[model samples]
Structures are given as C-alpha cells and as structure tokens.
Target: MAENASLLVELLTEELPPKALRQLGDAFAQGLVAELRAQGFASPDAPYTAYASPRRLAVLVKEVAAQAPDREIVVKGPSVKAGLDADGRPTPALLGFARKQGVAVEALERMQDGKHEVFAYRRSERGARLAEFLTGALEAALKRLPIPKMMRWGAGDAEFVRPVRGFVALHGEAVVPCSVLGLAAGRSTLGHRFLSTGPIELVRADDYEAVLEREGKVIASFERRLERIKQGLAAAAGDAQIAADEALYTEVTALVEWPAVYEGHFDAGFLEVPQECLMLTMRQNQKYFPLVGRDGRLLNRFLLVSNMQVDDPAEIVHGNERVLRARLSDAKFFYDQDRKQPLQSLVPQLAQVVYHNKLGSQLQRVERIEALASAIAGLLNADRSLAARAARLAKADLLTGMVGEFPELQGIMGQYYARHDGEPETVAAAIEAHYRPRFAGDALPGDAVGDSVALADKLDTLIGIWGIGLAPTGDKDPFALRRAALGVLRILVEHELPLDVVELLQAAHRQFPAGTLAEATVGEVHAFMLDRLRSYLRERGFKADEIEAVLAHQPTRIDDLVPRLEAVQRFRALPEADSLAAANKRIRNILKKAEVVERAPKAELMREAAEQALFDTLLSLGPQIENHMQDRRYTEALSTLAGARNAVDRFFDEVMVMTEDAAVRDNRLALLAALDRLMNRVADISRLAA
Candidate 1:
C-alpha cells in the first residue's frame, strides 16, 4: 500500500466523433485523476496528461500509490438511556451494536453526542487496493462521457460512443489487470489503422507516445497533433494565409492521428460565388483549410489534413481535387438556381413554411417584424421604408436553394440577393445585419437601419415567446429566449438609445392578434428584460446595490441609468450622505406606519426652529434640484440635495415626530414626506444606507 509508481490508462476505440473528442478526453482524465486523489492513492500534486486521438482516449498519471492508507472510523450507536434497560444489563441495542463491531458489549464506549450520551465503536478500516478501485473509476468516467448518442456493439451489454477496440492500463512497466467495455486491460495499443509499421507492445508506462509515433505511426497527444497540423499548414501555404479558424483546427486535429498537409485546387470560376459561401463549403462540408490572399479573399487553392504521410502524395492530391470539384459544382448550381428569381419572390413561398405551430407561419412572423422595424426606424429618425423593406426580405432567403443547402447562409445570402435585386445599399446591408450580435461578444449592427431592424426582430421574438409562457426554464431554453433578451438589452444600453424596454415589449406584443400572447404579460416581460439589463451592468463593473437603487425609480431611458448610478455614488461619498440616508430610512418607516394622510404641512404650525430651518432649505433647494434634474445632470441635482443634511440631522436631534399634539405630528410627517421625494429624484439612495 505504501508503494508509488507512475500509471497509464488508455481506451482505444473506433474513430470518435471529432467535434466532442477533446471534451470527452478531458472529462475522462480529470474524473479518474480526481477519484484517485480523493481515494488517497494519488498525491495532491500528482500531474497527469490526457491523450485523445481519433481512435483512443488515454491519461498518464504520475506518483500513484498501489493502494490507499487505512483510516480510523467512529460509528455511533443508541443513546445511553436507550441502551440501558432496568438494572443496566446489556440490552438488545447494546448487544447488537457490539455484535456489528465484532467486539464485546463492554468494549462499546459511551460518548456525548448531540446532548445525549451514546455508545460508539471505533476501529481502523483497511485501505482499498488500486486494482479494485480502478474498475469503478474507469466505468464511472466512461459512463459520464458527453456522448450525444451511445451504441452497444456485437450484442454485448457494454455501451460507448463508439465500438470498443482496446483498453490499456499500466502501472510503470507492470500491467494492471482490469476489465472495461468487455476488454481486459493490458499494456498494448494499436496505431494508425492503415499506416502502422507493426503492432505496438508497450513495455513501459512513459513510452506510450514515443512507441506509438515510432512503430505505430501515430501522435498520441491531442495538443501535439494540433501543433503538427499548424506547422504543416504553414509549410504548405507558404506566404499565403491558411484561413485560420480555431474550430476548424480543433476538428482537424481530432480527425487524424498523424497529420500531413496536402494542397489541392479548383477552377477559378468557382470563386465567383461569395467568398464566405466558398469558405463555408470548404471548411464545413469538406473540413479543408481554404487559402486566402492578403486581401482576405479566397484563392483557388485549399489544404487537406491527410492522416497518412505516404511516400507519394500525387494520387492523394488528385483524389481530393476531384472530390472538391464536384462539391463546388453543386454549390455553383445552387447559386445559379437561386439568382434566377428575385429575393422578394421567395416571400410568398414562406407562407407554406411553418415557423412554429403556436406562432403561425414565417410569413406572419415577417409581417410582425416589418411593422416593428418600421416603428423603431421612426423613433431613430431613420428611413422607415428601408427598415421595413429589409425586414420583409430578411427571411425570404430561408427559402432559397443556396440557403436551403446551407442554412447558415440565410442572412448572408439575403445581402447578396438584395444587392442583385437592385435594392438600396442601406436596405441590403440591413437584411444581413439584422441578425448581428448573433452570439455573446459578437458585434452590433453598424448602420442605423440595421440597428432598428435588429432591435425590432429580437424584441418580437422575446415578446411572443414570453407572452405564451414558453420562456426558458432551468437549463432548457428551446427558443433561446435568454439570448434574445440580452440582445435587446445590449442594443438599448450599449448604444445609449433612450427607447423604453417596456414600451418596446408592449409595441411588439400588441402586433400579435388576440390570444396569441396575453396583454397582461407586459409587466412580467418588462421585469425580465430589466433583469438581463441588470446582469449586463454587473458585467460592466457596477455594484449590485447601486444598480438596485437606480432601478427602484423604473427609469424608462437606459442611457440615463449610468449617470443616475454615478450620481448616487457621488451622493454616498458626501459628508452628509450617511446622516441623510439614515434620516430618509427613518422617514420611510414612519410614513409606512402612519395612516393615510395626504395633507401638506401648515406653515403656521411650523413653530420649532429646527423644523422651520429644514423647511426653508427644502424651499430654496427645490428649484435648483428641479432645474438640474430637467437637464439630466443627475450628479448636480443630488449635490444640491446634500445641502439638507445639516438641517435634517438637527431636526432629528432636536425634534420628535411622534408628539402629543395631533396637528404638530401631522405637520412633521408632511415635511418628512416632501423631503424624501426631492432627495430620491435621481435614485432611492435610502437603499444604499449601511
């Protein structure tokens, strides 16, 4: 149990799903290493390396013990009162407890447990063997893999992402006997299915990668494979760019065990299609890295990540080119067929494509989007017809042959077709840009018309989806409503637009016919949108309580929120901020407890000098604060209100609001209520009080 040695484990299988192979490899390695550390077989500082190839998942861990050390355990039994019966003779509870611990009744000691004396048994439980614990760990790690679909092979009960081919577990040079997925563990593995020089018999734990690369013709490390691919791409592309994309690189790394880059080319006429379309075809469909010129346009050449490093790549290059030519031919066919009809002609066909059963067809959704975009354009002083036209044609491309083949090209193809239809440049740009900020950290639309349509389109989705109670729940957001909400907030707050989110929700939902979405949902949707805005503000580094203070006023204009928060922050730092905040809180409590009394304080009843002084200050500062607030200079307004701190403190110190005289008490209450309103004009600073 005290011995320690480096260990290696590998699960060699058929080719794994490339997109998720990296994630699966990491999860398996971390889960096993964590289990070993938790079971006391692995040191806290033990290092491990994860290896994922197209056919295998493996981990090499250092300093793993053969077994975990024994530990003491305390088992509690019945309380003393329950254990003793009559003359304190050994009762059934005491007898049974001693029998379970395999000790005499006299050996059971009594100890205080939770205010009661209870019998307890203490002993050392033997540590577990690594060979015994490893089977469970290996099974658990494989069971937890992120496999979208799992299948069983050869009528076996074992299930995995792919069919099991091999399972290798080694402790240094010794084989750790275990069974996984119907395969006995051993220090053996297969390399490249086609190019392996010979069978690999691993003699040592640390020689896995080296042996695989030498005799088995495979690079075992996922990272090493990525580096090899990157270096090979550089050499193959020369001075030209390889059109680098991380996702494409990762997938390619997962697809090959030994990478060798081969260059292929298609006819220059295929470049007539938009570069984005061509690039997507190569990257998404073929998994090829398209070469781009210095001007960022796709060239006729592409690079393939072939798994084999053959003596002659002439035949491989020809085969890749022949395959790519056919792919490009289909792409050109779709492009030519799509341009035959104007983009607008596709609008009538959308009526047949159901957007959602509850929301009717795509044509109906477009009508709602068109109206909302037009309204938004009016508020932004943009050309209304351009926004409307863009919204009308935005979804038309959904029916195009090009877009039907590649759904990702919906908006992009819309832009191209809009231009081909001789639409205004602004409208054409808007058609594509309306879906901007598609994901988190993505850019917002560049043009005014684009912004208008983007906001309107996202708002329509949020309002309709939220109105029908189909909003996101827990981890499930089938409609992506949360993303839609955040997009709406980013457009409003980040753009500094003064549009009221609540009003936009109302305007959007109203466009839907009766029973489509509840009219009563206006308030709920407003609160939800504000919550997204709150999260957005926190990400920008605003304090939580400060945001709460400003939001209490329900400010309609998001552009004014930051200035209001800054004004409250400035108010908190003032010399009188603490005293005024305390007095405001006290006034709020008093008003809550007091009965309905809307009457103003009588001037004749203000006899006390402290009360009179507070009133005079408020009367003088009233106009100044009002003027500053009107100009949206929130900081200046709150600064003017801070002048009342001295008077407010004095009044609280020298006067008591709950007096025996009824008339005087009402007057004091009225004065406090009036002061509270003026101080909170910008924000509810009372919430900021300590």
Candidate 2:
C-alpha cells in the first residue's frame, strides 16, 4: 500500500442545469467515495469535501491510498480423496488443478474437506493500482449519475449530463494517469470563462479550492457559495425581509461562480397588482429575490444576484430593472385582463378544458367538486353555501391569463379574482386555501370552509381518476393520487375533523354516475388512504410498531389515530406492558381456534379455582374499562387493562383452558375471547409484541 494523501478530482464542463446541479455533484462525490472504501483504498471514516459550481464538479478526499493493500489468495482444488489414488499419490485431478495454477502437483497443499480432504493453493496477490481501477470507477459513477437527459458533442461517441470540457485526476501531488469520457487526465483547468487571465495550474490536490477561489475567482463549495448569497442578500435588503425561499437560494448559488448582490426596483404602478403575481414573475422569470416589508407585503425593491462585480454596478442594476419592468408589465396585463371577466363568468370557459378523456370536462369535474364540498361541509357543520361556492370558483382561474402564463398560480389567482368579483370573504378565502397543504409539510386549509372545499377537490380527482383504473403505479403518479390521499389524511387528523373516512369516500363516490366506479372502488380507495395514514403517522414521530398496532383495527375516523397512537405509546411504558402484550397474543391464538366469544361463560361452569378468580376480576375490570372507553379515555382504559396482568398470568398458569369437559372447554374459550376483544378495542395489542 502507498502512503495516504489528499486527492482531488474535477470535471470541468459546460454550465450544468441549475436545479439538479447540487444533486448531481453530491451523487458523484458519494459514489466515488463509496467505491474507494469498497476497494480498500480509502477508509469509511475518511473526511471529504464536495465542490460544485456552475461550470465544474469536484471532490476532495483526505487520507486516500494510492493503491489497495495486497491480500492473501486462497484457491480450492479437487477433494483430497478424489485427487489421490490408493497409494496416496497425486492423480489426474490434482495434476490438472496444479497445472491450471501454474504450479507443480507437489506444491499443492491438502486440507480436510466436508467428508474428505481437499487440495488447495494459497499465494500472495498484488493489489490493483488505484490509477488503473479508478478509470472504471469514474465511468461507473458517470453512468449512475441522475441525469434526466444526456447530451453528445462533436463526434467522439461519449455522452454526459453536459459536454466535458476538461478532466483532472490527481493523487497527492502526482497526476494519476486516466481517461474519462474520452478525455485524458491532466493537471491544468481553466478559470472563469470571462474573468480568467489564463488556464489555472493545479500543483497539489489540497490546493484545488484555494487556487480556484483566488486565481479562478470561484467559490467552489456549493454550500459556502449559498451562504455568501444569503449574507449578500441580507446586506442589500437591510431591515426588509428577503423572501424565505431555500430552493430559490440554492438555484441562484448554482448559477454563479462568484456572487454579487444588488438591489433593483420596478414601477410603483405594478404594486397595484398582487404581490404573489409580481413576486412569481421576479422569481420565475428573472430569478430575482423579492423583498418584503415588515407588514408581510412586498416592497417595490427586489434583490438580484450578479455573477460578476464591477466598481460601478449602475448599468447592471439598471439592466436588471429594465428586464423586470417588461416582465411585470406582462404580469400586470394578465391580471388586468383576468379581472375584466367575472369569476363566475370564467366557469363556462372551463368546459373547453379537457381534464381527462375517461372522466369528463373540467367544468363537469367542478360540478362534482361543488356537490362533494357541500356534502362535506354539511358533515363538518360548516356553511355549505360558502364551500360549494369556493369549489365552483376554484378552477375558474385556470382559465385566467395569469395562470396560463404561470400554472403554479392557479389557486392563487382564483383568490385574487374572487375578491375582485365581490365574492364573500369566506368564499374568496376558501378559493385559495382549498389547495393548502399541496405538498408534504405544507400548511393545511385555513378553516372549516377551506377544509371542506379541499377535501372535496382532492376526492373528486381521486375517485374520478381511480374509477377509470388510472391510479398511481410504481412512481408514476401522473394524477398525484398519493398526494391527494395524504392531503385528506392530514386534513382529518390535523384539523381534528370528526369525519369518517369510509363515509367520506362513499359520499365522494355517490356524486359520480351510476356504475362509473368499480364495486370495490370504495374499499380500494379506503385501504389506500389507510396505507397513507400509517405512513403519515410515522412521519409525525410515531413508532412503526405503535402505528401498526393502531392501524390493525383500521379505525374509520382518522382523527382518532393520534389518540390511539398516543395510548399505545403510553401502554408500552407500563410495567406490565410486555406481559399484557404476550398474554393478549396468547389469548388471540386460543380464540383463533374457537368462535364462542359472544357465548357468556356460565359462572357455574367455571370449575377451576384459578378460572373463577380470573373471571371474577374481569367482571369488575371490563365494565370500568368500558366506561372510560365510552368517554374516549383510551389512556385510562389501557391503564385499567394493565391491572388484569396478574389475573391473566394466574389464569394461564393454573387453569387448563382445554379441559376435556365440553361445557368447561367452551366456557374457557368464551372467557379468553372476551378478554381478547376488550384488550384490543383501542389497538391490536399483538402487534406490540413485536
């Protein structure tokens, strides 16, 4: 093995896609380090740093060996008995094996086999050179990159995420000779495309980042570059708040080799439009960071991340402002044109929009949503009129010019247009809030009206799509059914709505035409919803076993899942939890063979002393637990059930459950079944046994 030293590898390329740049760089570094560890050239604990920029991807690892360590080689030959004759001399088998190994028969050693001795050869094998092995490793890593599209350039038959401009691989201070993607490894790489004086020379592996930052004028670390932009934004925005957008920040970091923050402004007339419209234009069109005042509203000023710095940035700021002016003008035009039509008037235009050929037009879907929303609102005891009205107008903005330009602003534009059309505040708020919690960890609907409308909107899509057998398969959820199911689950649980999942699903299905849904459609959708519920609970910090125990009973009211999970969590902490869990499992097994749970065990039939004692204790405990349970006191009920552990243990220990007498055996089985039923009312206790 060679001495350990720092290693650096950089692949200079054309500008990478900004959004996926960080992910690609991180994956490349991770794959490279993992291969090094598996090949015995780098320790798992070795420190490493990944460097990514708009123009290059690089990784630096500390304490990487130049070659893998040599290992002892063991080669097995034929069994000793098969290789030897009656005289214990080498036979043809041994001779052939020795010849294949380039050794004589006498040089082979014999060792005991399973039923006989086996001939084996042992020797030292030199480890492969890192320079040679890394060629394949680099190729494998490139092949495994998460590039959605690979492009080819200039007729070499090599393809990559982008065209490869330069490739450098260095171990310590020496260049590890290798070729990747048809480019030979070298120690020279270019600096900034516009600002560089000449090609930057990398003398040592450790000098890669320092040389790039100083001579190349590049902040090579993605994270450090992001921090620079954040600090720069704060400095430029002063007391005003920059929009709290992590994704936007990360994207801008990937677009610049060196970052310079500058403040720009737009016409105060554009401020008449909604801030969402203006900010969306700023972010999506220009990648500019919009500033918000202390009142949580947008200021006229916006921050821009420049790739280069000049002593006089007047032209840069003026140029950005000029670009933003035309962008905002188009947005203002869309908003003004959208408001020219009443919100309700736009509803007819949706008829021309095809939602799904198998389902119906968008207008028909909206009608279903309106009906479902009113039903859900009635169940939730909210204003049904407002919910239906919100559902009616939710898709109206999809016809608007603003949404046509920026599809992400569909619900947001509906809210603006609804208010402009003089709709009720409740209805206007619901129009936008209905799409709340659009993604995981997002905020849910703002109130009961929003919740009702949101549920109806999601279920309309889910039932309509699933009825046609177009539900998500594998990762191909074109309809986002999983997201819809999770949204429904989050609404019910987070809002503490007392709606039953099955009833809601059945109600949603009823709005469809007769026979439009499969016979098992409701059941299938409910089960899928339950599956999502289990995962949602786990994400909220519940244990897997706790969630499984609660889900086993398949409670219809998802709002009650948390209470059951909490009770199970408390049950696990009890002193008798293990015994109760084991006992419940035993009771389940016994009852699995008998169906006499409803047949009351006759008091006179309990002949065994231990059985009578357990029966008497259950008489007092079951009713008390049932009383607390009727009041939804799950914790108290479970705590009360814990008191039955000693009686249960004694019953199993001293009583023969399968007495030969017919009446006694039936009564014993009945008693065990009754215990099992009471214990598992909140959750299937057997799952806790795991």
Which ranges in model 2 have alpha carbons more than 4 Å from their true place?
A: 1-4, 77-100, 105-107, 110-118, 595-597
TM-score of each: 0.93, 0.94
Off by over 4 Å in 1: 231-244, 310-312, 569-583, 599-603
Model 1, range 107-210, lDDT digits (tens) per residue?
A: 88889998899999988889988888889888887777778788989978999989988889988788887888889988778989998855589998888889
Name the weakest run of 10 consecutive residues (lDDT summed) in model 2.
Answer: 593-602
Candidate 2's residue-wise lDDT over 145-238, tens digit each? 8998888999899999889999999898888899999998899998887777889889999999999989998889999999999999999999
State the weakest 10-residue window (summed lDDT) of model 1: 594-603
| Residue pairs in candidate 2 whose N, alpha carbon or C atoms collide under 3 angstroms | 80-117
How does candidate 2 score on lDDT? Answer: 0.89
TM-score of structure candidate 1: 0.93
